[model samples]
Target: MTASFAAPRYIVDGGTEATSVLRRLARAGWTTREGFALPENTWDVSGTRLVLFGRVADADTAELAVLAAARGAGVVAIADAGSDVGRALYADLARVGPVSVDPDAPVAGESDEPASSGPQLAPEQRALLERLAGGETIAAAAAAEFLSLRTANRRIAEAREVLGVRTTREAVLAYLRIRRETREG
Candidate 1:
């Protein structure tokens, strides 16, 4: 039987940057809807083909994006591309599958540390560490890397020990520092 697909719905925010991005999506043929407030449940989303576009400015909006993506909708936040909220949303979505980002999007922050006066990571550990540095939670990073949460946590703990750190955040920062140093050297 031929599969039936629902028409995709676009959710846009009221902010200027978000609005500009919405206009771009509209010009590209997406029918847009205003996301005035986040829905309380996934059923409130209304459309099977949902695309949440704009900046997720608050926790509720981020929750809405997560709900939408959990229900198999495509969610794109174009405005807050480099902020913590953006990264959190991206990490949440990345847990389910690959999501798209604007090509010119800025990373949340930049680092300027010098390179590997530090211990090295194995390839798998490095992969997980990089994901964590990119704003992913330990569980989410593990999911992205196709590892069990337990395994990911173990690897993270091991990495922290190797890097002489005591927390996941420290491990991520340390890894990013090394990466920057390697890149700049």
Candidate 2:
């Protein structure tokens, strides 16, 4: 006999780093979707989870935390270790007892090459490489996607691995080559 588990669902917001992290997590066995707005009063929270990669300006974090607690869903928030808001939210949610905070943790992993002779990229990975080609620093490219510096670096490293290159510059060249071939195909 075999046992099966349902994929954990996630409602997330932030920038590219957040989406990239979420995609990796999903590939590792979680179900995810982008949810920028607060859940409606009638929205069901029975079987889903929420992750806030950065501060949200429009939603009340405290209330959302409480609601998630009441519904027995877990909530995770990522924030800068030095930010007052991050500390306050962590303390407050600690009191609520169902929230976890990871301050300044790095998120991202290396991309691996496919077994075939040629390299391919997911759309997001291609976009990141494109940004790099356009002269954006890794940090800047990540910021444009709302990803943390660490996460961005990880994605770049992964890109290098996927392209079978050893350096960031090589990764960029490989990406360009792939893009050109794709276009000319």
Candidate 3:
């Protein structure tokens, strides 16, 4: 058998508030040595696993984020609904493709591709989802795992971002589906 090589995929993100978002997400295991910077031009993202835009400052930046996501084929746009910049960035991303702004909605357009092609789940994230699948509440799961509520919710959010789903229920279902398929294949 011949060995095959595939280039490594990394996460590329930007925006005024991108650093903090990157910090939280980095803890979940998406490695990025190319740190967050203000998005000035549309970056080449076809090699990236994810393109994240957090609180873009202007319409141009928002457009750039969408462009990068389109090329990269995966994206996560984070913004506050109450803030103008957040609303603008979210709106721009939504216009081009489905963006997950609400907690219960499908985030970042997971429908664009198969979940199998997405990133592998972190151990903690997978553990949480497994517990939820077994019918435990997130709060209870968190307590059982000895994780704080904030940390648990953050993990759930990170799982959603990685699995390209929204809401803990959806994350649980996705986790189960992925596991089942992987085992069968």
Model 2: which residue pairs collide? Answer: 15-145, 15-146, 16-145, 16-146, 17-147, 110-158, 111-158
Which segments of candidate 1 are over 4 A away from where they belong? 1-30, 36-48, 103-185
Model 3: per-residue Cα lDDT over 56-135, one tens digit each: 45656556556655454334444455567666555444333344432322222233343355466655677788989999
> What does the lDDT read for residue 3 in candidate 2?
17
TM-score of 3: 0.38
lDDT of 1 by residue, 106-161 (tens): 11111333234567565567889988887888889888877789877877887898
Error of 1 at 66 (Å): 1.3
Task: Score each candidate by Cα lDDT.
Answer: 0.59, 0.52, 0.55
Residue-level error in angstroms, candidate 1, position 162 = 33
Put down candidate 2 lDDT per residue, 1-185, tens digits, no spaces.
01132122122234554555565654544444333244666444434543333343333754564455344333444344345555455444433332322212222222443233475454346667899999998888988866678766776777788788899999999988877876776
Can you give the TM-score per candidate against the true fold? 0.40, 0.39, 0.38
Clashing pairs in 1: none
